[model samples]
Target: MENLELSEGKEGLPYNLLAEKLVLGSILTIPQAIVLASEKLPIEAFYLQSHQIIYKALLLLYAEGKTIDYINLITWLQDNGLLMQIGGTQVLLDLLSQLNQSSNLEEYIALIYEKYIRRALIKLGEEMIESGYLTKIPLETIFTKLERKFFLIAEEKPMKYLVSVEEGLHQILQEIEEGLKLPQVPGLKTTFTDFDFMIQGFQKSDLVIIAGRPSMGKTAFAFTIARNVARNHGMGVIFFSLEMTRQQLLYRLLASEVEIPNTRLRSSKIKRTEWIKINAIINNLSELKFYIDDTPNLSIGEIKLKIKTLGIELSKQIGLVVIDYLQLLEGLKSTDNRVQEISKITRALKKLARELNLPIIVLSQLSRNVESRINKRPMLSDLRESGCISFSLTERTFESILSTRNSILSWNGSSLIREKITHFRITGRKPTYKVQTSLGWSLLISSHHKILTKKGWKRIDKLTLADLICFKLILLSHNKFSITWDKILKITYQDLVPVYDLEISQFSNYLTNHLIIHNSIEQDADIVIMLYRDEYYNKNTVEKDIIEIIVAKHRNGPVGSTKLKFDPKYLRFFNLKDSMKIV
Candidate 1:
C-alpha cells in the first residue's frame, strides 16, 4: 500500500515493516495483546507513519475499555479526523492480513524495538554531525549537549517485566538473613551513633531527599557520609556536583578530612609537621573509592548515564550517589515552567534509584515561606515547591534594643552614646523566650540567639550550665549608662510570634579588653545533609560551631534530628573530638 512505504528507497535506515504489521495485526486479532505489547513497545517503535497511527488509535481504545476491533478503530480514527491522513480504513485492514496466531509476540516486539533503536542512533548521529559543524558554539557545550542526548537514549532501555511474589519474597529473605550477620545494621553508616541508629543507615535503592536553605552545610554532610563509607567500608561514592568545581570540592574534602583550615591549605601556611600529615593523608586517601563530577546544570538523564557508564568502566559498585542540591539540576528537556520540570526531575531521579539499585541523596532548596512566623522549623508544607535559594533568617543582635524604644545606649569607643535606631523589623518567627536576668532586666529572644560573654558568645539555651560564662549588658538609668556583666535568672518559652529586630547606625559595638561583639549578623547555607546551624542565623552564636541535622524525610524510618559539632576554622563537622568544643 502507498501508506506502508516499507523503508524502501530509505536504504541505510533500519526498520522492519513486516514485524510492525504483524504486531499490529496480532493486536487487531487478539485485543488483549495490546496490554503486553503496549508496555513492551511504544507506537514510535513502528517503521511507517500509518502503523504508528493505527497503534495510537488501538492504545486509546484499549485505555477506554472499548473493544479493539476493526469497526471501533475505523470509527475512532474517522471521529478524530485522522482516517485519511493515515490512508483511511483500508490501511488498518491491510495490517490484519499479515496476522500469524502462533507467532511469538515477544520475538517480534524485540525485533521492532531493535530497529527503533537503530533509527534513534542514526538520528542522534545526524544531529551530532550538525552540531559539530556549528563553529559558533563552544566545543564543551556541544559535547555536553550531545552526551546528554545519547545517555537519554541509552537510559530508555529498561523494559517492563512481571515478577512473581514468591520471587520477590525469596530475594528479601536472603537479604534479611545476611543483614543479621553484620556487625552494624544494613545500609551504609555515617558513624554518627544516634543518627545512624535512628535511620539504620542509608538503605539501597532509596531516594533520600535532603533539603534546606542555602549554606546549611548540605555539601559537608555529603562529603562526611561519602568519606565514612569509602574510608571505612570501601564502598564507592559518586558525587554529581552541579555546584562547586572538582578542585574546590576535593580541596574542601581534604581540608575537612585533616581538620586543616581551608584558608591555611590554600595559602602558604602549612607547617612542616602539617605537611607530613597532609602527605600521609594524600597517600592514604588516593586508594579510597571516591569519585567527583562537578559538571554544572546536569540533567537527571545525563547523571544516570555517567554513573552507569562509570560503574561499568571501573567495575566498582557505587554504594551511594549524591546530587549537590536539586535547584541547579535541569530536566530532560528545557521547559519554561520550573514546577513541571522539577516534578519531572523528581520522577526521573526516583526511577534512576530503582534501576541502578543505589542509595541516592538529592539536595533540594526549601521555599521562602519556611522563614515565616507560623512555620519556625521547616515543615512539609514548606517543601511543596521542594527547596530554596531565597529566605534568609534575620539575626537580631540584641533583645536589649527591643526592650527600649527609638534608641539604645551603646559604647562607641569614646563614651556611652545613643546610636540612632536605623531600622526595626520583625525578622522571623521561631520558638521565642523571655530571658529574665537576676538584676530585674528581661529581654525577649529566640532560645539559641547568642549573648556577649567573657569567654565568648553563648546561646541562651545553655544558660543552665553550672559554671556560667559572664554575660555582659548595657544598663540605662535616667540618661546615665553603665556597662555590667549580667546572669540569666530564668528563660520562659513564649508563644510563636514575630521576633523583633533593631539595627544601630554609626558603627557602635561593645568591646572588652579581650573580646568584641558586633551589632548585626548575616547567615548563608550549602548540603549531603539538610542541616540548620543556628550560628548562620546568629553569627556570634554558641551553636555557630554546632550543626543540627533535620531528617525532613526518611523513606525507611522515622523523621528526626541530630547534632554535629562544626569547626568553622577547619570547615569540618565531627563528633566530640578532644580539641573541639562549642563556644
Candidate 2:
C-alpha cells in the first residue's frame, strides 16, 4: 500500500516511467503478455503522452487480431501514419531493448495501475478544491460528486475469472448444501404469508415492480414491507421517496405504527392517553434500522453513490430499497421522449439491484389509458413506458392474454366485471372477487370461524375471560373509533351463534353489554367501535376511505391482490383479520 507521491518536476506529475516501459516492452517481447496486461491496465494507466499513444496503437492491433511483435507494431503505427509522432522506430527499438522478462508483467501492470489511481486522486482533489470555492454549488452536491469519484477509483480491483468448471461446480454444490440446512434459506421476507411463500421471500439481487394508478396504496404497501424487514427482522432498509418528503413519509409510518389517525398527529390533537401510547410506539420504532432519502429527481448514479455511502457508514448491508415511485426519477441523460428515458431508468435500477445484491422495490404509475378502459385494473401494457417483462410469468397465462384480442369479462358478483387483460392469463379457480383492478390482481376469502371466548357457552363454543379481554384489546386497537361493549358483544354473538346454529337467547346468561362496558376502561376502547356502530346506525351518513394494494409484478411469486383495511383518520392499514377480528 505504498503511496505514489506527486513530485514538482519539469515532467509535471509523478509516474512509474520504468513500469510503463516494462509493460509495453514485455508485450512486444511476448505478444501473449498483451492479453494479461490489457486486463489489468487501461490506456489511461500510461502517464506519458507518447506511452499512451503507443498503448492505443497496441490496442488497435490487439482488437484487429494482429500479432503485437516489434515488426507488426512498427508496421501498424506506420500504416496508421502515427509512427513519427511517438519518436518513430527508435522508440520502439528502445522499448524492445529494455524488455527484461515477461515474468514480472503482472508487477509492471499493477505498478502502472497504482500510478493511474494516484493521478486520478490528485486530479479529483483539485476538482474538489475548485468546487468548494464555488458559492453557487451546494456543499452536499459537491461532496456527492467527490464521493462518486472516490468510489470509482476504489472500485478498480483486478479482474477475476474461474480457474476451471470443476472448481465452480464444487463451490455451487457447497453453497446448495449450506442453503439446505437453513430453516428458510435466509432472505428478506415480505411478512405476507402467501406472497412470501410464492416469492420465497425477496431473494438477493431482485428487482420488484409494484405498479398501480395514483392513490393505490403503493407507498403504504412498500412501507409496510420495509417496516417488517427492518423492525421485525432487524435488517437495514433504505427508502427513497421521490414524491413525498422524508417527514411526510415518517408521518405515515408513525400513523400506521401508533394506530392513531395521521390527521390527529398532524394537527397535534392527540389525547393525553393516546399520547402515552404514541410515545411507546415511538420507542419501539426507534430501534429499527431504517433510512430514508427523499431527494427529488435522483439519478441512478446518485442512488448508487448514496447506497455505497450508507453501506460503509452503517457497516451493514441494506436489505431492502423502496423507491416511492419510478416515473419521477431523472435519467442519466435527458431525452425528449419520456418513455425511452423511463426505460433506461428501469434498466439501470435492475442492474443496481443485481450489483448491490439486494431487493429493490420500485413503485410505478399505471398509464391513464387504464381509466378510459372498461376495467380499470392495470395490465402489463399499462406500465408507463414499459419495454418488456423483466421477469418470468406463467407461459400459458402470458400467451392467453396475448392471443385474446377482446377485453376479458369476468363475474365478481351480479355485476359483470370487465378487465383489460393484456399480458397475464387467468389460471386456477375463477376469481370470486376483483378486489384490485389496477394490476395482476386476485382475492382470497376465508370461511373458518374460530372465536376465542373465556366461558364456554352452551350450544356455542365459549372463550375464557382472558380470551374475551384479548379479543377486545385486538378490536379496540385495530380501528379508528372507540367501540361500546354492547357492540362488541353483539358482534361476538353474531360470529358465534350463526356457526353453532344457536339462538341469541342462548348467550343471554352472560353479563349485559352495558355492564361489561362499565367495567372496561373507557380509555382502552378507541373510536373505532363507535365508528362501527355509526356505520350500521347511520348508514346514510357514513363515509368510507379504502386503499387497494395490487401486486403488479412479483419476480419469484404469483401476481395477485390483497386488501388491507385503511383508516384515513389514523392513516393506518390493518389486515382483514384484525379489522374484522370480532366478526
Candidate 3:
C-alpha cells in the first residue's frame, strides 16, 4: 500500500517495489553501480512510479557524466521540476536508508527485470482474454497477432559485453580455419553455376529481392532458384506462394522438368511419350524437399510461423525461403498507407531472414517510374518515387508553342507566374504511348509515366476513357494562358524513342506542349535481381530465347548479369552452357 503505484495494476500484478528501490538506491548511493545497472535495467523496468522518476533522473545525470550523488541528482530534479512529482528529498532519504551494499546491484537489477516481465505477462493475458468478447475482430487474426507478440517477448537477444576486438578476431579466424576443411561451396549451392560463383551461393541471412515489370517472368525465375537449391543441396526450401495456387505453381515446375508445354499438360493432350516422361519425373520431383503454401494476402508474421512450423515438423533446416512478390504480402492492420505498409513488409522480411538465418528471396515489381526512361532498365532510383512525369514523344502543342531547356513556363500553385527550366535530360529509348483527348489533341507518353489529372496525379498505365487530363488553354486575346480539364478519348503504345526530362527552377513539374505535365519520384534489399528478355520487346531479336537476369544489387559480391535460355514452350530457364549458342 505504501508504493501503491507499483501494486495497483489490477491487484496481483506481481511487482517488487523493494527491488526497484534497491536498484535506484544503489545508483544514487554508489556512482559506479550505474555501470552495470545501465546495461541490465532500463528506467521503466522499475515498477514504482516514484522509483521510475528517480531512476530516470539518475540515468540522465550519469549519461551527462555529471556527479550522480544526491546533491547533483536533487539539483537536476529541482532544475527540471521533477523532484516534487517524485515525492521530493524524503523518498531519496528512505531509499538510502533501506538499500544494502552496492555489491548486490546486479541481483537487484535482475529481480527488477523479473518482476517487470511477470507484470507484462499478466497484462498480456488479460488483454487477450478480454478480446475474446470482441465480435468485430476475426479469431485467426487475433491469434496471429498475439503469436507475434509472444514470440518477440520470448526471443533470445544478444547483450553487449566488454569483449576485446582480439577475442572476436580469434573466433572469426577459427571459423575460417574450419571453413577451409569443408567443401568449396560456402553457402547453399544452386543450379546456376555462374550465379553461385559470383554470389558465393545464396548466403544465409540474405534478403535477395528479384524485381521486374509484368510479363518479365520474375515468378518463374524465383521458382527456378527455389527448386534448384532445394534439389541440388538436399535442403528444405519453403515458397510462400501469394499470387499463384500450389497446383498452378507445381504445374510449371513439372512442365519445365519433363520438357513438355504447360498447355499440353493442362489440356491432357500430351503425347504418350510425354506422359511417360512426366510420370517418370514426378517421383524425383516429390523427393526434393520443396515446400509451398498458397496462402493469399499473408502477413510477414504468418509466413514466419509457417516456415518455422514446417522446419520443426520435418526436422530439417530451411535453406531458402521465397515470397512470390513483396506487394502481395499483407501487413498488420494499422493506419499506414500502401507505401508505408510495403516498407514495413520489406523491413520485417529482412529481420525475419536474420532471425531464422535463412536466405529469403522476395519478388517485387519495379515501379512505373522505370518506364519513362528510354533505358527502361531499373536503377535503384526507379523504386524511389512513383506517379510522376510524362515523356511525351508526339510533343503535341497548342498555338505551336516554342520552348527550350531554359524556356519559362506557367508555374502552378506558386506566387510566381512563371519559372525557367534550369536543365533537361535525354532519357534512353522506351516505347511511348499515345493518349488522345476529346479536344482533338494527342501526346505520346510512356506507358506508366504519370500526368496531372482532375482526380490528382495518376499513372498513365491506370488511365481510361473516363478520366480527364489537365491542359493549358492559350488565351490569344490577352497573350496569356488558362488551365482546364479535357476528357481522354484514346490511348495506345507508340514506337520507342529517347524521352526528355526538365528541371524547373522552383517546382518539380512544368507545362510542356500546352499540357501541365507533372514530374518526379529508392530499395533496402540486400541483393536485387532483375529479369529481362529481348523477345518481349523485339520480334526479331538475335537472342530470342534468352532471359537476362541482372544482379542489380549484391551486398557481399560483385554485381553482374548472366544469361539463361528461355524455353517459352516449356516455361523453363536453362543455363547458357547447357543451351544452344546465344550469339
Give the best candidate by TM-score. 3
lDDT top scorer: 3
Candidate 1 worst ten-residue window by lDDT: 519-528
- Alpha carbon lDDT at 157, candidate 2: 68
lDDT of 3 at 253: 90
Clash statistics: count for each candidate:
15, 25, 4
Q: What tens-digit string does per-residue lDDT give for candidate 1 at 379-482? A: 44345243221111123334544445656554533345555565555545665666666766555555544455544445565555242333343446654544
lDDT of 3 by residue, 156-217 (tens): 23244557999999998998998899677688777676667667788889988887888889
Q: If ranked by TM-score, best first, what sequence of candidates would result?
A: 3, 1, 2
Return the lDDT, model 2, position 26. 82
Q: What is the lDDT, from 0 to 100, of the residue 441 in candidate 3?
A: 72
Q: Better model by TM-score, 1 or 2? A: 1
lDDT of 2 by residue, 161-278 (tens): 4279899899989978988997572567766554454456777777777766666567777788898889767878999999999999889888877777777789999888887888
lDDT of each: 0.67, 0.58, 0.71
Look at candidate 3 and tell me the lDDT of residue 130.
Answer: 84
Query: Candidate 1, overall lDDT?
Result: 0.67
Q: Deviation in angstroms for 101 in model 3?
A: 7.8
Candidate 3 is scored at a TM of 0.68
> In the order shown, what is each candidate's alpha-carbon RMSD?
18.7, 23.4, 15.8
